[model samples]
Target: MTVDYSLPKPELGAPVRVSPFIRFCRWGLLFAGIAYGMKRQRTLEQRETAHRANLRAQKVIWDEEQKKIATQRTREQLLQLAKDVNVPIPADFDTQYPPA
Candidate 1:
């Protein structure tokens, strides 16, 4: 038995063209992907906005609570907490709660 180590040669044929249906499918897939990406981006942006607004609302509530506590009692700790949380204490704070 003789063994042949020769490689097969490449063959060239007529050029092939894409079918109309396949081209249409390709464009359809591209548009679908773009639409999905836009939808996902909008969803994520809306979620982020809601999250920020929620955080702002929580901070406002916390600030108000601190100020309320400070107003109820002219204690040093509560007053400090309100000042730090609300920033530039309200003008009435000085007149209403004199330092001890």
Candidate 2:
């Protein structure tokens, strides 16, 4: 048996004008970028949901405080009205009167 290793080989046509392998790599990179963008959008949505919940809780607390202040103001005004009319003021007028 004889081995044909005597002659050396030449380059094949200036190494293919444009490589298909490079194009496939570029497409893979593009797909990865798209996936990252989608994940970021979902993260933003979760943050917004949490922020909205916090805002709602704060609003409820503020509303309760405002109601207390309004009740106090009404009680003071009624006491003044009673004094002006020479009427005896009740001790528990706030508890008895309905807030408008």
The numbered model that scores best in lDDT is 2
TM-score of 2: 0.51
List, residue by residue over 1-100, the lDDT tens digit for candidate 2: 9988777777577555667889899999999999999999999999999999999999999999998898878877888899999999777775676555
Superpose all Cα atoms of candidate 2 onto the true structure and report the RMSD in Å to 1 decimal.
15.5
TM-score, every prediction? 0.47, 0.51
Off by over 4 Å in 2: 1-33, 84-87, 91-94, 97-100
Q: In model 1, where do residues sit more than 4 Å from their true spots? A: 1-14, 62-100
Residue-wise C-alpha lDDT for candidate 1, range 40-98, written one tens digit per residue: 99999999999999999999999998887776676566577977898667778657677
Query: In candidate 1, which residue pairs clash?
Result: none
